[model samples]
Target: MKVYKGIGVSPGIAIGKVYVYSHKYVNARPEKISSVKAELKKFEAALKTSKRQIKKLSAKISRHLKKEDSKIIAIQMHFLEDEVFVEKVTRAINGGKSAVESVREVLQEYEEMLLKSEDEYFKDRSLDIKDVGYRIISNILGIKNELEFIDKDVILVANDLTPSDTALLDKSKVLGIVTDSGGLTSHTAILARALGIPAIIGLKDFSLNVREGDEVIIDSENATVILNPDDTTKAYYLGKKQEYEDRKKEILALKDIKAITRDGVSVTIDANIGAPEEVTKAIEYGAEGIGLFRTEFLYINRFELPSEEEQFEAYSYVVKAMKGKPVVIRTFDIGGDKDFPYLGLKKESNPYLGMRGLRFSLANIPMFITQLKAILRASAYGPVSILFPMVSDVKEVIKSKDILQQVKDELIQERRDFDKDVKIGIMIEVPSTALTVENFIGIADFFSIGTNDLTQYTLAVDRSNENVADYYIPLHPSVIKLIGMVQEVAKKNGKKLSLCGELAAFKEGIPVLLKQGIRVYSMSPASIPEVKKYIREITLEGKNIPDGFHQGEVDGGL
Candidate 1:
């Protein structure tokens, strides 16, 4: 047996045949169409074919995955049917361009539009249009390409894989994945992690060096790849694989088990989800509830805000799918480093400090109320919680609660069925919130520390900026003190609190949080098992709690 090593992204072991997705475009000779009318006819036919292919793929996705996972496909179908896009394509083709050239020209224009966008979500979605366009052109040309899945078990290597490509992969036969392009936040990386397949992305020249059906062993923990291994290395990896499988089996047995520590301490293991389709995957990963449901996705990617009924339908579907699990829906937190062209939010000089989170919601009160009403209406179906983001003071908290009450009152006066008693909470992210925790103690139902922003705000470092990314550390003395203070205030007020930041999933941060008296930890479902294992191993009985009162304890908190 031979072993090849690559960077491990997701953590799991599989032995499968290699499946290579070649999305290479073949340059074709320019076609000769006599007139604009003929070119228009060809364009129309291509559009029809694209629509049919989109619908077929969408149906296949709906059958294989949840609606949320299939939402992008549905959106692609809408794009194909969009009047503006159709008109653009028609005009281009009628201007005496070949069918493929017209489609390519239209796609280039759309891609430029997306690139000019300030929103990362919309910017990343530019690839979707390109993918769909490529599919249309390939299908029209009668290309008979096949995925190169090797007959023997091997790791799948690619430049960058898409969700559709990953879906086509036989999970039973693939070992792991290695890619030369992709980031941690990309959909491809997210899906691979969710599927429990070890993946390593961002390796330059990985595709050039790795050949088809090459035996490989990936150590994801250290992000290392070995190529053409010897007998001893193969033996070592085989033993490690068996040990990993055994541990996974043990964790699977705890799927339905509560995440209670040996000392009778129970912590809620919830999932931080973006779209409604993620609800099913959350449940499958043993998430007890939806801790953080970012609702801004509903307002994004369109020319206008979603109607109240549209928001209600989407929120209601997610709540119903959860059955009775607590779903905490956060109001729109946009306009900070993130932007929407349709909202007319101009590019800011310093977006992180500008209008965002609760500030943005308060500015758009009607938009906020619309979302609040939808959450209230959905609460009737199951347990729902409302959370406000980027709050720094009691005034913002009170104002938001008042607006929520106004919506409830309006619904009540109109004799509408809405839940008035939905729990209200605040995301403890600002430095002032951390310093004046007492002011919000009794007013808020729960406090969820968004360490991502809190760390940035406290250390005066922008996490997204690579130059200062290292300075945006959660282990910084100031950041640790703020978290400890938040926990102390929550405990003093006899209120429940949880940490719903990326730090909550960090092994180092989890121990610190447990010592600082944080009992609830909310994270991505994929991180649950390893986090649980870390929590289970720590003995807190004799551990000294890091008190934020003195600078020494504050320093120790880090």
Candidate 2:
């Protein structure tokens, strides 16, 4: 028996035969063409065909999956629509290169640069380019490309499944996924989680070791894969699979129940989402409200800025859907790992410490005002609060509030219908902000602790870097103390405080945070069920609230 290990992105188990799926590798040989005009025309036609196929597939997938999942295909369409990509390919073709060769050469260069980066975000983006490049070349060559056919229950193994390739998968037939190249943030991993499929990615060359119809046992709970398991091992895994399924069912049973402690402490469970479509899943999972609606999705993966009308429509859709539940829309945290080319941002040696979050929005006054106006307009529909990310100074909070008031005055002059008393909040992600929370109690309405960035900045470790990933500990004594300090200050001031980050969903960290006086926890929608179950199991009998603060009084504001 052979055993392989990889990162388990989606949690589950599957004991089945192997289904070795493969994509037709397109090799564009360096062919020299005589007619530049003819080659350019052929390239343009191929691009159009590829785009149409993507749109059709996107429409088809939206009918079955969440609209956010269908967005994977829409992002691919952006690749075809990007002017920089088209111009580079066109320039290469005009220099006497064949359409197919120009596409392969240009995309290969782009992919290579991204692959060389340490960031997994860049690596995932390269896969999209690779997927789009493959389709364009195949269309140019007249090679009929179709999704892999799965006939029965099997562990689907591949080199790497692209976002589009994973979207076309038959979720019912594929018991599990094992990919040779992928991380937790990869598009395939994201789709697998959305589909509730068991996935183990980054198993380099595991496909080469297995043959079609070979018995495979995927233990995603432990990130283990066993090939040709013996009877004893099979029996052990069969029992394990049953336990995992039972645990899932038990956790899901808490969907309708409130996330309250056994000792009579109440904590609000909310979901963080990138787009309005994800609000449906959040509600299905029993999210009390939308904690962090990342507004950057509207700006990223596109060639131009999203107009005010576009932003207003999206914010309104989410706000109305929540039906009066408090929705905290974080104004575009764009920079650091999430960068847009249209912003014309300079390349910084250290992007995390560079102009990001509130700094970026403040510097670009026009863009910030447009987003502020859209958010304020949407507040008329339901309870909406504007959240500023990566805030460190007291002055930043005052400056932002000033701009918000200015926008409100402008809307009033235009006779626009909007909520005049919209709540203003700031994220306490920086160490400096957490340490000085007392100063902001009178300035901001509420505070949310972004533990992801707090841990990174405090520990001086890049969470994305694999070399020092072990040092990125969120539960370190110093970090936990910072969280406790912020909770204490917020509670003393009677300002509602929520914790939104990966740390919020952590089962081991939740009890500690509750003991530290945090009352609101926000996490990914998928994690809501499990986290609620864990919270229901927790009891803080001996834990006393600091300063005799009433627990019921904290759940009042945004």
Candidate 3:
């Protein structure tokens, strides 16, 4: 009769027996020594085998679920092949430990760090390493570790589920998901949404408290999980479940409807995506175009920069799929918070302000132009435009366009077909850049206000620093004034302005933003329907915006 409240990352309901899944402690530090080369070879073979298995699982899951939910397997496979991880395992083996013993030792270091990390995102990442470690060690020992579904429907309770674990799960038998740790951006939440299952995350200790086969009701809509509920509560949830299903049907009906405001103002809503596969999900959710195709994923999950042809294939896939629905692709916004160790990027004391985004690209011009060439080549296929991130001045914009033009000249000599009219744009993220938007607006064809970084830099608060998290307010008066200024100038100069940050998804500040004349909104796929519906119901009605918008409580979206 106990009720536990958690963050509802996915919406729906499921009634099932509890199936608690946990990994057994592996203390297999062998007392005797084994041949280093033989053991190393054995570990290598197992690692190779695990890579194949993960690839197969990814392929199978992509066929059933949306491709975005299944892309994590590729990331794990990258870890399996990472030179650092490989060298560490080799070093451990050379230090006179058996294959299983050495592998466990090296992975345990990472597992412990993640479990001990103060940052919530880093702490949740332990689940991924542990899941992969289990696979590799089990492969070496010839052991099989997987979720065993009981004879009836069940809800999975775990500290957290990795993309590998969640991807291979028996979707038909497992009715819902409950996890001890994760956030809205976690893969567990994204996978659950893509799978259309009810899920609750950041449950704290329900995995430890809940028992096997105990009847439970997972109410994701209300973010509640009830254990051994009384008859009355069980009946109430069952009726509530029916109502949710009915509402889902109604929401789906509005998918093809236009996302126009109540005053008959037509607004364009697009989806921010990671991989090209996610473009399908965006279009399926009624995204008119790809607003922000983040190119960091191409660099993150690989050993080296993707070649021009490889990058071209990926970009062309989305460009063609949208069927002339203008795709705005942002170049590799890596380095700052998004680390690519294989690239040999120097360690910085203050990475957020150091080498990152457009700054990183400027330093590595050869690699930068390679990616630009690919995007330009893909532009020939369909509607495509390039957007730059972390831009601080008009000079960087001119320099980047100069390099792009240089590449275009080279492509012309080689007789390559590309859109000579590909548009160039910059993200207004830095406080200085936002304050002086008029200086850069003339050269840029369009602008997207990256509210995430704008809020961080404007308030001089590190969003990742938990101690100062309260100061990172998106609705602060200065932040609003900056955005208002950008909106006013972009309008007066006849330049198109859009909000592509996480703030675009939430409706809490919709009234304030609409009055600012932000007609273009881009967000995640799951947000499209809700945002579209909210936009249609509300109109500015010439409401006056408060001067000090930061007076009340504000929860930042992105």
| TM-scores for every candidate against the unseen true structure | 0.86, 0.88, 0.84
- Sliding window of 10 residues with minimal summed lDDT for model 2: 549-558
lDDT of 1 by residue, 1-558 (tens): 433333345765443334454576647654777787877776677678768866766665566554555566766777778899888877877777776787788888888887787555566677677766776666545553344344445578777775556655565556688777655544555567655678777676677776666566676765666666677877887887787778677765666667665666777778787778777767877888888888876665466888888888888888999988889998888876557778888677788788999999999888888888888888889999999999977999888988988999988987878667889899988999889988987689998888888888888887656567568788787889988988888898888788877787765576677778888877766566555654555567736332211010000001
Residue 191 Cα positional deviation in candidate 1, in Å, after optimal superposition:
4.5
lDDT of 1 at 346: 65
Candidate 2: tens digits of C-alpha lDDT, residues 325-420: 999999998788777766778888898898889999999989999999999999999999999999988888788889999999999999999999
lDDT tens per residue, model 3, 1-558 = 999988777778899889897765455444355588888888899999999888887887677555444656766776798898889999988988888787777888878965664334445566668777888987887766557444557898988887766776777888999999887657788678777778998889999998888988998756899999999999998898887677566666676678777778787888888788878778877888888899877664355778988889989999999999999999998766566656777867778898888988999999899899999999999989899999997888899989998999999998999999998888999989998999986799999988888888999998766569689887788888888999999999998888877577654566678877888977877667666766777657844322211111012233
Model 3 alpha-carbon drift over 4 Å, by segment: 1-11, 25-56, 65-71, 74-99, 109-129, 139-143, 182-190, 213-240, 464-472, 542-558
lDDT (0 to 1) per candidate: 0.72, 0.83, 0.79
- Candidate 2 CA-lDDT value: 0.83
User: Top model by TM-score, which number?
Assistant: 2
Error of 1 at 144 (Å): 3.2
TM-score-wise, the better of 1 and 3 is 1
How high is the lDDT of residue 388 in model 3?
Answer: 97
- Comparing 1 and 2 by lDDT, which wins? 2
